[model samples]
Target chain A: MKNHFRLGLFIFITPVLLWLLLLIIVPHVELLLMSLHGKDDMGRTVWTLANYRNFFTEEIYWYTFVRTALYAVIVTILTFLVTFPVAFYITKIVSPRLSGFLTVLLLMPFWVSELVRVYGWMILLRESGVINHLLTSAGLLDAPVEMLYNDITMLMGLVYTSMLFMVVPLISSLEGMDDSLIEAAHDLGASPMTIFYRIIIPYAAPGITSGSIVVFMLALGNYLTPKLMGGKNSLWFTEQIYNEFIASFNWNQGAAFGFLLLALSSLIIWAGLKISKQQLGKALS
Target chain B: MAPVLDIQHLRKTFGDFIAVDTLNFQVEDGSFFSILGPSGCGKTTLLRMIAGFQQPTEGKLLIRGRDMSRVPPNRRPVNLVFQNLALFPMMNVRENIAFGLKRQGVGAPEISRRVDSLLERVHLSGYGNKDISQLSGGQKQRVAIARSLVLEPSLLLLDEPLGALDLKLREQMKIELKKLQADVGTTFMYITHDQSEALVMSDRVAVMHNGRFEQIDTPRNLYSNPATRFVAGFVGETNILPVRASSSAPLQVQTSFGLMLRATPVGNCQSDTLDLFIRPESIILTPAESHEDINLFPLTVQNILFDGSNTKLLATVGQSDHELLVALPQNQQFAHIGKGDTVPAGVHVDSCRCYPRGGS
Candidate 1:
């Protein structure tokens, strides 16, 4: 019986262990080694801090990096504000059957690929697109105005793509909460607004933190949305890393930039957890 | 003085079903009032309406003589201790207790003072900084009560808050809650399905059934003199014998097993079919005392339920299916009586209570 149990455990764990080691751990280790070295004046392999120094010394690289992080934080906050009411409506404000239907409605957009959904938005928002044509014909606007290739459009794409991640966690956490808590708060002379901040938000903090972490990571690491929507004006940090790797064939510099992004994003998350007084372990659970 | 809560002609309907049917009651100032009923009996609906979480379909609810028909729950001068206690898991004991006062824009010092005093009242004086999860079940219950009481609302509603405790804790909390209510002097509107809880705590209890209150009287009166058949059956353990009322006397009833019993008459009971209720304690074991014209019959003991003070004997009529529950005398009066022993049981006229049977 013990041997059979061991066999079952091996069957379940083998693929996961192999996948993590080969796909994630091995490649990341290789990249960390690659990131530590750069070519010398002698045009041979050498170890140097030049690759790391290049990031802080250059204004565009550091500014774009900071901009991307800030944009990601904004996207995460926007997604949370938008998804909280949607989650509350689904879990508490509606009947079970209606909430089930509403959840399906929210999930329907995600059934299509993210690229396809972004392209769908692109088709609507571009100049001479369906929106501009309808607006001009209805006399809401005199001429077609360029709406794409802007920071706002990129952030919108980022928030939209990250919304489902925020929503699922919010819904699950909100569902686990007792309705009596809200009622009890109200019974104890708490107004609706007070209850929202004191009771609902605190109860759903773990969900919010987990969702924010995911949304922030997704927004920062996103390549397609900023490139396609913001066009040439987009100075996303990942784009610069991509430029270093594919355009210039600078594998060492690309690896260094990649590690920097990873380390800095993690540092930001740590600072955020400290500021918000939430433990990552609690949020993950 | 106006009652703290006066609910008049309150009715609540959901689609085709009525939850609370045109109910009228008044909870006096500084009194402990309990609405005792089984689940789905609309006691919860009535409590929610009074708390202002729900609106009555047609009626007026007055709190301290002011109409509260249009008021929301938060605006009402009331608080509720929920069944599961609903203590904020995120906050410490002090924060949970001071939540209502904080919402009311009270000063920080005032909130702290009230919370501390209230915590002391509930016997958790120095444990204000402890997390809610750190407290035991009984302690959590006291915190939930202190959380509500700190607001000093005109009325505090408790929705079976003691139902979640263990049997021993429930028994302990029952007495503690009664004393707490007496100490606080706030009008308590407690809702529970536990008959003993209501009888032990409340100054008056409203026995609800089928969306309406069948009896709203003192606990003693409600247990001894239930106004309706539902109340009589729901309040306590009783042998309800379906019998045909005899036209020969005003309160004479003949059971289906061919036994006739006389009861103290109720006014204007004109129905021929009635349910005669006899409490288990009312049935006296034979060979003890002789009485004036009481109904006596022989019963075969089937089983002895030895539950300490509440021990009872399960018996049936001689060679018949008429079962009777006789409360065993705690004084060892029937100590020698065992199963299959034939004993005579006597029920006095006053002990036999009768209510007219209703239609299907």
Candidate 2:
């Protein structure tokens, strides 16, 4: 009986193991090798640190990398600030039916592909877009104002795209909280603000960490939204990586930038876990 | 002295359903008052209204002679010990106890002093630095009480705070809670569904049913003289017999088993159909022949339940299928009473209470 159980478990796990080995581990290993090598004088690939050094020496690359990280951080904070109240309302304030309806509405944006969604934002945010037309026609503006190809537009796109990821975790965490705790806090003479900060926020820390990590990673590695909405001024790190791999045919440079982005996201996630006093395993769960 | 909390005709309704129906009562200062009822009896709704968590659809609430209609929960001079003892998981024992004081803007030294003293009072003196999860169930309960009492609220509302403990712990905490209330001397309004908990801890208990108080009196009085059929069935173990009025006397009721019984009528029970409640312990077996006021009947014992100190004899009176529960005393005389024994049982006329059937 034990052998049969073991055989069933092996059969169930083999497909997943093969997929991970062939698709994820193998590609990452190739990237790691490519990132650590550079072209020799004879046009042969050889092991070198030149590709990694190039990123630090080039000011534009480093600046754009830091800028992308900072933008991702801002987008994460904005998404959290917006999603916290929304999640709380759906989970605590509304009835179950309304909560379900609101959740479905939140997920409606995901039905379309990311490329289509980014393009939809571009249509509304361009100079001759619907918003500018409304503003100019309504006498709010004398001329069409340039609303696209800026940091604000890029950040807006990032927040809008990553909202569902933040809300889902927050709703899960907030739902787990017993309503009696809030009442107990109020009974113990805690004001509304104190209750929010002391009880609600602490209870939702794991969700906040999990959501922020996801949003930050998505925003940092995002290519399509920044490209379409940010225009020429948008020098997001992923754009730089894309230029290296596809535009400039610099595979080694692109591979190095990919590793740097991974390192940066890992570092930020670790710091966030430390600051919130939450275990990574718990937060992810 | 004036009452600490006065509720006047308070009612709460959700559309057509009434959760609390015109509850009017006053809780005396420094007295342990409990509202005892089964679940869904509106006791929780009434307690929430008292704690300012729910607003009454009608009527007024007065706390210390001040109208409290507009007061929110945090602003009201009341605190609640939740059923689950909702201690903050992020705070340690000291922080949990000091939370209300800190919110009141008390000085740091004063906060620590009050928290330390409260810990001492609750018998958790050296457990200040321990996390909330580390403490046992009883310790957490004490911390929850201390956290509320430190605020010095005019009234403390305990919503079945011992319901989460095991049987042994619940019994132990009942005495512990009574002692704690006495030591603190705050007016306590406790709500619970357990009759034993209410009887053991409360100075006075209000038995509620269908969004109204069936009876409110001392535990002894409630057990001895229940005002309604619901109360008699709810407060303790009793044998309820459906009966109709008999022409023999004004208080005589004829049982369904064709036996005539007399009981002391409660209130103005003029209904033809009535209910007679006879407590198990009040029925005597093998009564003296000279006792003319006692109602005697022969019962055939079907089963003997031998619980230590609570042994009971399950028997049927006459040939009726209706079972009568009789308590056997812990004495040598009744030691040999077992199943299939036919014995004479007697209940005094004053020991049985009769109420009009279907009256709340």
Candidate 3:
């Protein structure tokens, strides 16, 4: 029995250990070392804080980073507001057969790659694309309107891309809720608005918090949606990191930006958990 | 004063199925009224209508002399304690108990005072800070009750709140609920499938079968004098015998198993055919008096089903395959009776209740 237990443990755990060490920890360690080193005056690699210091000193870098963070937060909020009702409707309002069908419908778009999905939005929203062409021909507009390459278009793409992540968790949470709780609240002299806020929202808080975190992280790290949909004005922070490594040939600066994004996002998530009074360990389960 | 609740010709039907077929009953103020029925018997539908959760397809439902047909559940003056004890899992005991009060625009201090008093009344004073998950089954049961009772509505509806507890806890909560209802002086309209719960805690019980109430009366009368065959069969353990009447004045009936029995006919038993319901405890083992009206029979002890405080004698009536369940009186005098013992058994003539065959 002991040997069997040991063998089962080895079978379950060895792959996870190998994955953490090779894929995550090893790469992160290499990036940290790369981020810490910089070329000195003599053109020799030296341990320096110059790359980290440049992020604080430069106006465009910090401004773009803050803009990216702001957009990610906005996208997260928009996704929540848009998808919360859909989750509630699917879980509580719809019949079981239709709920299943609606869930499948939600997942059908995710079958295609994210790049292709974003490109699909581009095809519809571009100046000479389907939406503008229809508007011009249908007499809604005298000329084709430039609807793409703006913050709104970019935010729309981000929310659209991350909707399923928010919705799936919200649906799971709402599904576990007992309908009797809502009735009980109503029977106890609670108004519809009061019941929604006091009962339903509190019950769905964990799902909301986790979904928001996931959507915010996705929007922050996203390069494709903002890059394609957002034209010259899209000063997303990831583009800065990409420009450092590929355009400027500065791996050290890119690595520093990457580490900074990770640290700042982690700090924001931790602060959010504190404000919402949610435990990450509890929410994940 | 008007009754706490009055339902007149209330009917609810879903598609072709009648869930609650014209329920009409009045719940007196400060009285414990219960609707007792088996699962899927439309008792829940009746309770939901009273609580304003479901609208009656047809009829008038009045609460405190006001028509509630157009009222939403939130606007009604009734609060329901759900079967699963739907306490808000996200809130602590204090917040849960204060929820209804908060919705009513009650001040914080007043809410706290009322909640604390109710918590004390439910024997959960110090447990206000505890999360709902932290409490045991019985504690949660009390919290659910307290959550509704703190509102002090015109009527409190309990939907099988004790159904989730273990046997011992259920028995314990039954007494606690009865006492709590008495102390609070609020009318309670509780519904449960458990006859014991309904009988033990309720001042009056409506025995419902299908979509209609077969009988609604005091628990003692419901047990001893059930109005219909469904109520007699569903209320408690009773030996149902298909017997034919032999006499008119005293009303004695004869069983098909070749055993003669004396029983009173309930309702109009115009037809000779009757379904007699005799309680297990009423079956007297060896009558001392020789009366002309009483019918006696010889029962051979087939088996002794010994359940402590509820021991029963499984006896075959007069060497026939017809079985009779007799409550074994636990005493030194009857201790000698065992398996395969031929004992003289007879039920009192008045104790036997008979209804017309095939009549609900």
**TM-scores of all models?**
0.95, 0.94, 0.96
Residue runs of model 2 more than 4 Å from their true location after superposition? A1-26, A40-47, A135-143, B248-250
Give the DockQ (2 decimals) of all models: 0.87, 0.78, 0.85
Cα lDDT, model 2, residue B282:
92
Cα lDDT tens digits, model 2, B178-288, are 998898899899999999999999999999998999889999999987877888899989999888887534488889998888778886677778888899999999987
TM-score of 3: 0.96
Where is model 2 chain A poorest over a 10-residue stretch in terms of lDDT? A268-277
Considering every candidate listed, which one attains the maximal TM-score? Answer: 3
What do the candidate models score in CA lDDT, each in turn?
0.90, 0.90, 0.90
Model 2 pairs in collision: none
Candidate 3 on A147-256: residue-level lDDT in tens? 99999999999999999999999999999999989988888888888889989998998899889899999999999889899989987989999999999999999999
Which candidate, 1 or 3, has the higher TM-score? 3
Q: What is the lDDT of residue B45 in candidate 1?
A: 89
Classify candidate 3 by CAPRI docking class: high
In CAPRI terms, where does candidate 2 land?
medium
lDDT digits (tens) for residues A1-285 of candidate 2: 999999999999999999999999999999999999999999998999998899999999999988988889999999999999999999999999999999999899989988998888878878899999999999999999888898888889889999999999999999999998899888888899999999999999989989998999999889988988888988899999899999999999999999999999999888878887889898898
Lowest lDDT 10-mer window, candidate 3 chain B?
A: B289-298
